[model samples]
Target: MMKMWRVGLDEAGRGPCLGPLVVGLCAVPINDVALLVEAGVKDSKDLSIKKRRELVDWYKQQMDSREWKYVVNICSPQRIDAALSKDGLNILEVDLFAECLNSLSQQLSENVSILADACDVNPQRFTDRIIARIRNWPWQQSEMDSIHKADSIDPVVGMSSIFAKVTRDEMIEEISQQVGFSVGSGYPSDPNTQKILGRLVTSPLPHSELRWSWATIKNKWMEKYETPPPIRNESINVQKTLF
Candidate 1:
């Protein structure tokens, strides 16, 4: 029998007002799908920080053994801003997810099954958009679905989330190191993030890692600098929803 591949895709830092949007892809042989669940893989959001860190390490070891394969694409704040300025978040995600799929497809054989955590409110629409962007389809008898909360529903997507979450956290730490202070989780509700924003906005130039297009940052910039923060010209209409 031909080996079957099961793939999952998810993203981290989508809601954060800072940091890059990191998309993760994880794949394993269909029969080995149980291995992920047996190894306690679940949505990163449901895992504790220590647990998530531990799983990330374990996953790296497994990938090294060729037990499975994975890929990650980190979309920087600047690129994200540019995307938002044009087509919007949905298009950005579709493009990025397709990019990751293309990379993964290069490594796999036929009969691949892919499940993606939906970036759009309409799951089928999101799936269709991604499929439309993929350069290779039906080339390998592949099937794909994008659904809301796939990370929680599918172990593979949960594993993908673990990768994305850990990677984004490390990136945030690097940004903190560069800034010489902690930027917190980069979420708007994070007090440390809010505090850092206050300090960062006073600077004559915007922070490179900060998402200036975010309303949070724009408001802060306007409040402190007494002028609208420079953002891309949004010439195209898109879904008004931010997340």
Candidate 2:
């Protein structure tokens, strides 16, 4: 019997003000979906950090023996800023998401289906945008589904989310060690993250590893030192002065 693959796509750290944006793809045999669910896989957000880590480790163990494959794209703060400079955030995400799917397609020879958690308001439109990116590929005919909260509904996407979240958390920890303190999940709402940003701004412009393009950072700079607009002087009445 021929084998079939199901690919799940998801991202982590999109809303965070710090850390890399990670897009993860997980491809497994169609028959094993039930097995993964039986192993306690669910949405990464619903799982504790320890459980997510454990699941990721278990997935890794299955890669070689079970023919399961996965890929991750880590868009660092610098790369994200560069893309955001040229294209808006939505377009950048579409490009990144498409890249991940296309990359995953290369790893499989069997028929595959893809499901991604939608990042845009319109799920169908978001799926169209991604398809447009890979229209020329051989796998363009592959089934694609983009839906809101797919991670929670689809166990495959849920597994992908877990992979992305775990990978991003590890990356943030490594960065924290380099900076000598906890960065607090790299989200703007995190008080520790904000505290670190406050300290970095006082030092200089273009702080290394920070996304200066983010409104959070820009607003902080503007609030502290943005100069007032120069007042314009009314043109003098030269004729009246001469009279």
Candidate 3:
């Protein structure tokens, strides 16, 4: 009997003011989807850190047995800034999603049904764009489905989300150790991140991982360097797209 596969892709750190954006892909046999469900797999956000770590360890074991396949694409802060300056976040995500999918497709020989947590407002459009980007796509009877909040609804996508979240979290921890200070979650809303953001234009860290194009960084640069700041009535376009 031939095998059929389900490929799920998701991302983490898209909205952070610091750190890299990570996209993850997980491919499992269609008949084995229930195995993941029975093993308590769900959205990463709903699982505690310890739970996520436990599940990741289990996933590694499964991979060792060739029961599944996975991969991740890390988009550095510099790469993200360049994307924003060129195409934009949506295009960047499309590329990253395709990159991850292609990595897994190279190893698998069966038809795949791709499920992605949509990053674009129009889920169908997102689905179409991804299909168009893939190389030698539609292998056998392959197909793709992109839906909003797929992580919460589809166990496969949820697994992918967990992989992405855990990878990004580890990277953030490494960055903290390197800087000798905790940067928090690297989101602007994070108090620790906000407190450290003021130093971007002043005592800039030797680490070049900071997203220089973010509005948070731009505002800090202007606040520290601009003289006689414009009045509130003046028009200012410091805000950058957050994807």
Candidate 4:
């Protein structure tokens, strides 16, 4: 018989300074997977936040029917740094994927195929890294692989992306409330995120929750301690989002 199953895998909070990295993999039969996609499913980025949310509920309904199941592996920032330092990010990511898929294998047995959003768009040595990483993990399925642009290509990945993004957005909103500002997406390029960092950098605050290794963070820290030459905008400008 032709191979007849599908899986969608994705990660959330990859760039966040706070919270865990949630890696999720969901599987559906190829037939139903296509049915779900044919119902106007697409990548998370292609839909509005509200639509993505609606899809999450619908996808959850599909899952609740026992037609599929998902696993969300949550790992803290410290854990990610430790693993990345041990063998670099790509390998560590594959290691995480291996762990998750290995668990999924016991349920699906040896017949299913696994597809993942390849961490690097153009992988060089990652293939070897993935091959080696899965060997020790429990997902002993003989055929799991990573492909570039998996999200754009795989309907499974599109669904998985919805779960990942929704989960991350909820966490971001919670964190914003806790921190008392619209810190934005927690990415370096986000101006609101930068503004929040500026406040923390200027105040006598400790680097308690921040990702200290970000280039922007490192540069700001150096400027604070070393007393670098004053720039045009030395003062912190934290844009308060009035609720």
Give me the displacement of residue 172 in model 1, in angstroms. 0.5
Which digits, one per residue and each the tens of the lDDT, describe model 2 over residues 203-233?
A: 3464555666687877666666683212212
What is the model-wide C-alpha lDDT for candidate 1? 0.84
Poorly placed runs, candidate 2 (over 4 Å): 135-141, 227-243
Candidate 1: Cα lDDT at 137: 70
Summarize candidate 4's per-residue lDDT along 122-198 as a digit string, tens digits.
Answer: 55454456556654433334456677767778878777777777876876787678778777887777777777876
Which sequence of candidate numbers ranks them by TM-score, best first? Answer: 1, 3, 2, 4
lDDT (10s digit) by residue, model 1, range 1-243? 778888999999888999899999988888888888998999999998888899878877877565688888888888778887779888998988988887876667468899999999899999998888777576567799988999999999999999889889989999999989999999999998998898777566678788888999999998887988876443432211110
Q: Write down the RMSD of all candidates, one decimal each.
A: 4.9, 13.2, 6.6, 7.9
Q: TM-score winner among the candidates?
A: 1
What's the CA error at residue 223 for candidate 4, in Å? 2.4
Residue 84 error, candidate 1, Å: 1.2
- Give TM-scores for every candidate, taking all chains together and pairing residue i with residue i: 0.92, 0.87, 0.89, 0.79
Model 4 regions lying over 4 Å from their true place = 1-3, 16-20, 121-128, 135-142, 201-208, 227-243
- Scanning candidate 4 in windows of ten residues, the lowest lDDT window is 234-243
How does model 4 fare in lDDT?
0.64
